[model samples]
Target: MTVALATSLGDDALILGQRLAEWCGHAPTLEVDLALANIGLDLLGQAQFFLGAAGAAEGQGRDADTLAYRRREDEFRNCLLVEQPNGDFARTIARQFLFSTWQALLFPDLAQSAAPAIAAIAQKAAKEVAYHARFAAEWVVRLGDGTSESHRRMADGLAWCWRFTDELFMDDTAKFRPEWDSHINATLTQAGLATPKPVRGITGGRHGRHTEHLGHILSALQYLQRVYPDATW
Candidate 1:
């Protein structure tokens, strides 16, 4: 269970980090670019810890670097949402809001896992997740209530991404390993944010199904690794 959770969480961080890294110089403002880059770095750090823990638990010869750089897209277990393109600033914030909320909820539960190493990594990552969620939530409020254009864009972003959001809360591991539903609700309630009703259309990412964008993302991320199998920079 710890290994599975760690691998899933690591995939989440890795994919999202890659997406946010795309915004480093392309964001609307220098401050926003720096903010996104900072968050991307935080996710990358979380990915390193979680992937390292997963590798250790699996007793595989592969380490975090190999898992991150060498894996094919179908082997990646990140949700469809994170792999989606950052359409606009509003879209990026929308993605961040949804993902960070889920991660904040996830890491706390993971911190109590039976595996000591996994728990330790989660404990460390929980801090970063907390800040990620807060930053995204603040941006959500700012954009949601800021201006007519901002509100329209934010709402459109949320609508475009809403379908994929359900995948984040799907529970298949018989024991309800993380109780993600309750955590999501609690976080949204605390933030005074409400998602659309019913919450249907939950999808399964565990089956290795992914959005069309995953292939492109994997292509870019794996280029250096494939070209120089043993090269280090």
Candidate 2:
């Protein structure tokens, strides 16, 4: 259970980091691009810690790099939300807003975990996730209350991501759900956006049944590692 939990956590950060990295040189503004890139780097750093912990828990030869690059799509345990395409600026912001908000709740709880190493990692990462959540939230409010087009796009983006929000709590601790609800509802209210009606969310990402997007991400992400095993800088 420990190994599986750690792996799922690591995969979430790794895959989302990759998704955020795709915004580099393509964000609506230079500041936004730099911000997103930095956020991506933060997520990658978290991934390293979590994946390393997973390897240690497994008592296997695998390390962070080995687990991250060697795993096939079906072997990964990231949530389907992180694997989704960053469709537009609005969508990217929406995804980050949702994921980082969850991360903010998640890391703090994990900081109290019995595992000392995981607790330490969670303590450090909780700070970073705080900034990520705030950054995305500000954008969500800004875009949502902006001009007509921005408002429409922001609403559309939230609609796309709304379904996945439920799965964040699926098969996990029930403690975070209440806090998550209050935080999300408050943010959406301030943003002048109503919570979209919940739909039946697509699941199975945690169980390694991912959408086709994970394969495309892994192909690019693992290319060099796959080609030259053990080669390093």
Candidate 3:
């Protein structure tokens, strides 16, 4: 359970960091571009810590880079939400808003985990994700209550993001749901958007059943390592 838990957390951060890094040079403004880059760096750091802990726990001689770059799609255990494409600014914000809010609630409790390494990672992550949630929420409200086009786009993005949310709470993270919903509801209300009613969401990412996007991500992520065959700088 400890290994699986840490691996999952690491995978989530790694994949989402990659997704955010995609916006590094492409955001609508330079300010947004830098913000996404910094956020991606933060997540990458968290991924390193958690995956390093997992590798240590597994006693397989694998390190963070090995676990991150060597794993196949079926071996990855990240949640489905983080793997979704960054469709538009609104879509990206919706995904971040949803996932960050959950992370904000989750890491506080994770700081209490019995595994001291995991607990320490969670302790530091709690502060980072609080800012992440707030950043995303500010955009959520700005776009959701903005001009007609922005409002429509924000609503559409939220609808796409909403289904994957159920999967976030499906595992041990279920304990955080009440707080998650409360924060989500308040944010949406403030944004002038309706709180989406619960529905049966797509699952299986946690068990290594992933969408097609992950395969593409891995091909790019692992290419250098695979080509070099463990060559290091």
- lDDT at 64, model 1: 93
lDDT of 3 by residue, 1-233 (tens): 77998999999999999999999889999999999999999999999999999999999999999999888999999999999999999999999999999988888888986489899999988998999999999999999889989999999899988889989988577888888889988989999998866667989899999999999888887899999978888
Q: Candidate 2 residues 205-228, lDDT tens each? A: 988998889999999999999999
Model 1: per-residue Cα lDDT over 1-233, one tens digit each: 76677778888889899999999999889998999999999989989988988888889787899889887777787788888899999889988987887777666776775478877887887898888888887877777767788877877777777878767766743234245445545544553455546545545565578878888988898888899897886
TM-score for each of the candidates:
0.88, 0.97, 0.97
Off by over 4 Å in 2: none
lDDT of each: 0.79, 0.91, 0.92
Candidate 1 wrong stretches, greater than 4 Å:
172-194, 197-202
Candidate 3: Cα lDDT at 13: 95
Q: Looking at candidate 2, what is the lDDT of residue 203?
A: 84
lDDT of 1 at 122: 78
Pairs clashing in candidate 1? none
Q: In model 2, how large is the Cα lDDT of residue 107?
A: 89
